[model samples]
Target: MANSFSGADMSLRTDKAVQRGPALQFTVDDQLVDAFSGESVAAALFAVGRRELRQSPRDSAPRGMFCMMGSCQECLVWVGQRQVPACQVPVAAGLAVQTLSFRRQHLD
Candidate 1:
């Protein structure tokens, strides 16, 4: 899979250049992922090829960012104790994110 983020820009369009903030580091499922400031958690994860953010509560099917605008709850993940949409949350330095896959693995 191609990286969704490049240099300081997170836009997939190569023709249009986007200015982004400083770089930051965050953890997803205990794996470190690099992200630029102003990037959403989902964006960072997609950049690193982490497509599945959670499994369906009922079926255990894989789920990832769909709408990316928070309209769909497909990208929900745990940040600390709260579950929030990954596409809606901004990447922060040292932020630890836990996907539902991790939880399921631990429970099993």
Candidate 2:
């Protein structure tokens, strides 16, 4: 089998680029969050101590980033009009993300 480097060199606060300068700003579920360059959305959220990214669609069980790679499908989140895996999306200034909790709140 071939090798996959999907998340081989990523960490919440270890990326050199991230440590070199100012962090970018973004919103998670309408709450402000900070993200550094070279950090994925998952890493950014995790940096701020956010573990549960979303919940199961069927049972509402808390879900988070299990496979920093893109195989687990556990980090699903909403960005604008589209649903995306948080682990696969890189962080950028002004980016907006909404987790499953947002949907749950509205359902109540």
Candidate-wise lDDT, in order = 0.79, 0.75
Tens digit of per-residue lDDT, candidate 1, span 1-108: 232334444344233577877878787777667787898999877766667887787998888999999999999988888889999999999898888778658643
lDDT of 2 by residue, 9-95 (tens): 224456455345456777787777766777788977786678898778799788899999989889988887778889999988889
- In model 2, the clashing pairs are none
Best by TM-score: 1
**TM-score of every candidate:** 0.79, 0.75
Measured with C-alpha atoms, the lDDT of residue 29 in candidate 2 is: 71
Model 1 Cα shift for residue 40 (angstroms): 0.5
Runs of candidate 2 with Cα error greater than 4 angstroms are 1-21
Candidate 2, residue 68: lDDT: 92
